[model samples]
Target: MAYLTLFLTAFAAATLLPAYSEVMLGAMVTQDYSLWWLWFWATAGNTLGSVVNGVIGRQVDRFKEKRWFPVTEEQLEKARNRFNRYGQWSLLLGWMPLGGDALTLIGGVMRVPWLNFVVLVAIGKGVRYGFVLWLVLNTAGVPSESVPSP
Candidate 1:
């Protein structure tokens, strides 16, 4: 149940929705949950959520003509231009809070291959979760047992 909650929180956090999985992870670390499991579930859930954003982005063009379309053509073009400049390597920074979600969305808009998208996103999110876990363990002084290899 604890892992489920963390997974869900991490998933939501990776989306456009506002969530703070790091806080949950930090708190859980203090409680001495298995570090490997926490890292795995959080990384997997977050990567999956980013994939959801990518899926939505792929379909965004179909709705561009609608009244409720969220982004303007100019704004989208600008994002596209930036994404093109950076290319797929930008996916490595998808762990950032402010623009990370946008990166994943633009990836889909640019027609990034699914395999590339998943691999890059998973690596980025996995490293982020790993860092969060490390920070929690080191800062909170979690015992050695909680720091086992993942």
Candidate 2:
């Protein structure tokens, strides 16, 4: 149940919706949950959420003519220009806070190969979760071995 909650939180956090999975991860770390399991579930959930965003990005153009379209033509153009300049490598920074979600979405807009998208997103998000786990463990003086790996 704890891991499921972590997975759900991480998934939501990866979307455009506002969520703070790091806070939950840190709190869970303090409680001595299995580090490996936490990292695995969080990474998996976050990556899946980003993939969903990418899928939505692929279909975003269909909604361009809608009265409620969220992105303006100019805004879309700017995003497209920035993404083209960066290329698929920008997916490495998809784990960042501000423009991270946008980066993932743009990858889809630009037709980045799906396998490449998954690999890059998974690597980025996995590293982020690992760092958060390490930070929490050290800050709490909880030896990595003190917690089970599971």
Candidate 3:
């Protein structure tokens, strides 16, 4: 049940949604949830969310003409060129506040190979979740009752 909630929260946070996975993660760790399970579910959920963003980016070219989204063809071309120049390396910085979502979508609109995108995004997100996990495990100090005898 905890894992399910964690996954959903993490997944939602990964998209443009205004959710925060870190809070869920911290609470779960504090509650003494299995570390491995927490990490796996959070990573999977977040990665899935990012993939959704990529899909949106793939369709951005079509929306370029609609004007509702405000992305122009020139902007798309520029993004495409940037992706071509940077290649998969751009995904490593996908956790950043400004360019993260844009990078994911640009990669999709530029038709970056699917496998490459998944791997790079996964690595980037995994690192982010891993850092959160470390914080929960170390500095937060698990409740005395929750900590099993060594």
Give candidate 2 misplaced runs (Cα > 4 Å).
Answer: 143-145
Tens digits of per-residue lDDT for model 1, 1-150: 999999999999989788999999888776647788999999988999999989988998998888899899999999999999989989989999989999999998888999999999999999999999778777787777645554
Candidate 2, 1-150: lDDT as tens digits: 999998999999999888899999988885757778989999999999999889988998889789899899889989999999978989989999988999999898888999999999999999999999888777878766667666
User: Which sequence of candidate numbers ranks them by lDDT, best first?
Assistant: 2, 1, 3
Instruction: Name the Cα RMSD for model 2.
Output: 1.5
Task: Show model 3 residue runs off by greater than 4 Å.
Answer: 143-150
The better-scoring model by TM-score among 1 and 3 is 1
TM match of model 2 to true structure: 0.92
On the 0 to 100 scale, the lDDT of residue 27 in model 3 is 80
Best by TM-score: 1
Cα lDDT listed for each candidate: 0.89, 0.90, 0.81
- What value of lDDT does candidate 1 attain over all alpha carbons? 0.89
How many clashing residue pairs are found in candidate 1?
0
lDDT of 2 at 72: 92
Pairs clashing in candidate 1?
none
